[model samples]
Target: MSKDVQERGLEIRKSVLGAEYVEAAFRSADDFNLPMQELVTEYCWGAVWGRETLSLKTRSMLNLAMIATLNRPHELRLHVRGALRNGVSKDEIREIFMQVAVYAGVPAGVDAFRLAREVFDADKDA
Candidate 1:
């Protein structure tokens, strides 16, 4: 990818995930994992998220459902926070999980709710 794409990705990633979180991710990257980080920043955040066809709020909601369906609690938790930052309401998130329960499985919905709650509680404590 071009330097411009990478820079845009980094900016968007930081805006969505928080500058501290993105900086820490880069800070902890080793030789083995650095490439993975670069790919995620450049491709996932820049190439995909940079597109203006869909709003960031829409993307965050879609990510929440897909990540929940895939049973990725870590990514789900991160995206839950991002979702809120992107203006996705808690009620909307609950509805998304409820939909996940119907199609994806009750277990997936349960885990998504639990992870979301953890993120919510952590923010409260912070």
Candidate 2:
């Protein structure tokens, strides 16, 4: 990826995911994982998320749905927080997961709800 793309990706990643979280990920990167980090930063953040066609809020919702359907609990939890930051109401999140339940199957929906609840509880504690 080009420097410009990586730079833009870094900006978008920080904005959506928060500096602390991104920085923590970067800090944990090693020789083996650094390439993966660079790839995601440049492609996912820079190329896709930086696009103007979709608002961050919309992107966040899409991300939540996709991750939940894929049964990616960790990613879903992170995106739950991101969805909130992007202005997706908790009610909307609940509704989204409900839809996931219908389409993605009950197990996926149950896991998504579990992960989302954990994130919500942690946020409340924080």
How big is the positional error of residue 41 in model 1, measured in Å on the Cα after superposition?
0.2
CA lDDT, every model vs. true structure: 0.95, 0.92
Candidate 1 — which pairs collide? Answer: none
Look at candidate 2 and give me any clashing residue pairs.
Answer: none
Model 1 residue 125 lDDT score: 100
lDDT of 2 by residue, 20-86 (tens): 9999999999999999999999999999998899999999999999999998777887889989988
The prediction achieving the highest TM-score against the true structure is: 1
Clashes of 1: 0
After superposing candidate 1 on the true structure, give the runs of residues whose Cα lies further than 4 Å from its correct spot. Answer: none
lDDT of 2: 0.92
Over 4 Å off, model 2: none
lDDT of 2 at 47: 94
Tens-digit lDDT track for model 1 on 1-126?
799889999999999999999999999999999999999999999999998999999999999999999999888989999999999999999999999999999999999999999999999999
